[model samples]
Each structure stands twice: as C-alpha cells, then as structure tokens.
Target: MESAPAQPGTAEWYLAEASKLRLTPLDDKDADPTQDPKFQERQRKIVDLATKSVALTHKNPEKKQQFEVSARYLLDARLQLAMTGDDEQVELLYENARAFVKRDPASHAAAHGAHTLVNLAYHNATQEKAPDKAATWRSEFAQLANHYLQTFPREEPRSVPLAYTAGRLCEQHGQIDDARACYTQIVQFTPDSLHGSEAERILRRLDLVGNPPPISGPTLEGET
Candidate 1:
C-alpha cells in the first residue's frame, strides 16, 4: 500500500524512505507533487538531524532516506560554500551531483545535476575569460556539455540560465549565431533574473554593441 503524505515538519522518517521514481512526466499536475525543485524541505530536515548521525551531514544520508541532494542541486549549499571560500567543497559538490545523475540515469530531472559539472569543469572554455587550468578535465567536461545540449528543454517559464549556459557553450564552439539565439532567449525569458548584467555583457560581446533594443514583454510593476 502507498504511504500517507508526509507533513512538512517531523517528516524526516518519511523523507528518509527513499525510492527511485524515474522517467516521470514533469508536466503531469500530479507528478511527484511532493518533489520540491530545490529540495529545501529535505535539506532543512537533514540539517536538523545532523547531530543525530555522524554520516548524514549533507554528504552522507542513511539508506532509507537518501537526501543525496548534491550541493550543486541545492543553491543554498553552493552559496554557503562560496561564502566560506571552500573550493574543495565545491568540488565535492560536483562529485555528489554526479552521484545523483547516476542514481537516476534516465531522468530529465537529472539534467540540472549536470549544471555544476559544466560550470566547474568547463568554466574556462565556455565562459568569457578562459581559465588557467584548461587541461584539468576537458574531455569529460565536453562530454557532459554535449549530454546537456541533447536534453535541454526548449520552452520554460524560467529558461534564462539554460539559454545562457547554451550560449556559453556556443561561444566556445565559435557558433556566433547559435550563441546569439541562446542569449536572445535569455533576454526574452527572464530578463529580471540575477543574470541580467551577465546577459547584457554577452549581448554586447556578441556584437549588439550599442544601446539595447527595446524589450517588449510584460513590464515590471512601477515601471512606467
């Protein structure tokens, strides 16, 4: 028999009972109704339970409850690591991310798990200023990027970051027009996101070097 829905708090017992649910339709209104995109609830529970088990400190979770949420998948965790100047932690974050990808090899949800892998593994080749350590993991990074490109969603209520990442990869490949489409999508989809400044830089870098063309979308409130 299926179990009852877990309450928000004190559901650690329930959350710990992990099960693999892959190939699930993202559009189904009933799809993983309990799944939070950022896994905040399980994370909160894990932090709360940290004192109880020496192994559940974000990296390790008891088998029954696999909070196995990679730091990359948890924006808050990544931000904390950045604040603490923990590059090693960031690397561990990628390792955890890879594990999530492995856990559900056929999952579309596993797509973003590849995000950190690309961001860290190929930040240089794809980003504007290539880094010094270009040789660290080029082949593996390229393979991951290709895999992401193959599975990327075309339409989304929030695809700015997705488009931006695609543009970066195009920039590396010298596909100026392909990159332009991706950046244009970024400006079109989520102009107000944290990527605004970076997106603007990219638009100009792609040769839209003058004043930005007037954007036509639902204007933000208070903007005449």
Candidate 2:
C-alpha cells in the first residue's frame, strides 16, 4: 500500500524536471477512434503493460533482448500518452525510452527523438501558448536532433524522419525556406515509408503556410 498513494507523486511533477534534463525522447502516435470509452480503457491497459514490460528490462547480456523490447514498449507508450494528451506521461515515458536507447543502439530513436523535440518546440513557438520553458525545450530538442543526424549518418529508410526533424526545426526557428528545403528532401528521399505520407502532408502544410521556394539539393546524409 505504501508504494501507492492518492496519485502519490503523479507523473506530472516530473514533467518540468524531465523537461529540464538533457535528453528528451521523441513523439509519435497510434490509430484513432480513440474517443470510444472501451477503446480508451484498452489503450490504458496496453500502456500499463508496456510500462511494466519496460520496467523489467535488465542490463545483463542475457537480458539484452528484453531491453530492446522494453525500449520499443516505452516508445509505444509515449505515442499513446501523446494521443490522450497526457503530456506528463509522454515526457516520463520519453525519459524511459532515452535511458533504454542509451543502453543499446536506438535504431529508430534518433529520428523519434527529433520528432518529439519538434513537437515540443513547435508548441512553444505557437502564438497563443508559449510556456516559460518552451525555448529551453526547443533548444534542447534541436541539439538532440543534431546529435542524431551527426551520429547516425545515412540509412535509406531514415531519411524521411531526418527530413521531418530538420523541417520542424527550421519552421520553429523561423527559417521558412530551410523548412521548405527539408520537406522537399523528404518528398525525394523518403518516398516509401509511412513517413512518405507524412512528407506529403508536411509539403501540403508548407504550401498552406506559404513558405514559398522549396529548398533544394542532397540531404545532410548526401544520399550516397
């Protein structure tokens, strides 16, 4: 009983602390029809299970496989939390994901990390609601993203995410042409994955926003 409290230290408190921390995980999502009560319940169960599974990951070599599963689980949970608007849980889940990635090679994490930072930064940049810490998170997220780009080099599948991250960073920083450039690159390089759809959507968004003059040339990876 002692382990639990009436929301004893609900994950909310850590949101600020976590935000201030050096590493914040990325954001992603799940299917909708999430408005249904039953579906919502199911989602919560899945999140709980995912949280537990991640909690069980061991550092030992024999348990290395579990670590990967756990990292992925946390990633899924982060997506779910974002959908439900539980930003605190999203942040906490991100911490777990980052810690997990550090333990091993986070294949998709580099991109995912960039994704979260962009969301955080974009929200901050919004006209109506830039919270006090918004700039901090925006900067922090950009650094993490640059770290990913620098560390990972080029993989055929990863270009779209990299493009998205770069585009979001440019948008947040007010580099409209740079943003257009990144999105255009996504259109060219990431034409296969789910990111391809995202790339198209972003291109549409850029058009709507009237960025004008898409940026051109090879991606940071040079597509070699």
The best candidate in terms of lDDT: 2
Encode model 2's per-residue lDDT on 54-122: one tens digit a residue.
454444555455444544444554555554545676577567546655755444543454455444443
Instruction: Summing lDDT over every window of 10 consecutive residues in candidate 2, give the lowest-scoring window.
Output: 13-22
Winning candidate number (TM-score): 2
lDDT of candidates 1 onward, in order: 0.47, 0.51
- Pairs that collide in candidate 2 are 27-116, 181-215
lDDT of 1 by residue, 114-137 (tens): 655555545444332444444333
lDDT of 2: 0.51
lDDT against true structure, model 1: 0.47
Residue 216 accuracy (lDDT) in model 1: 71
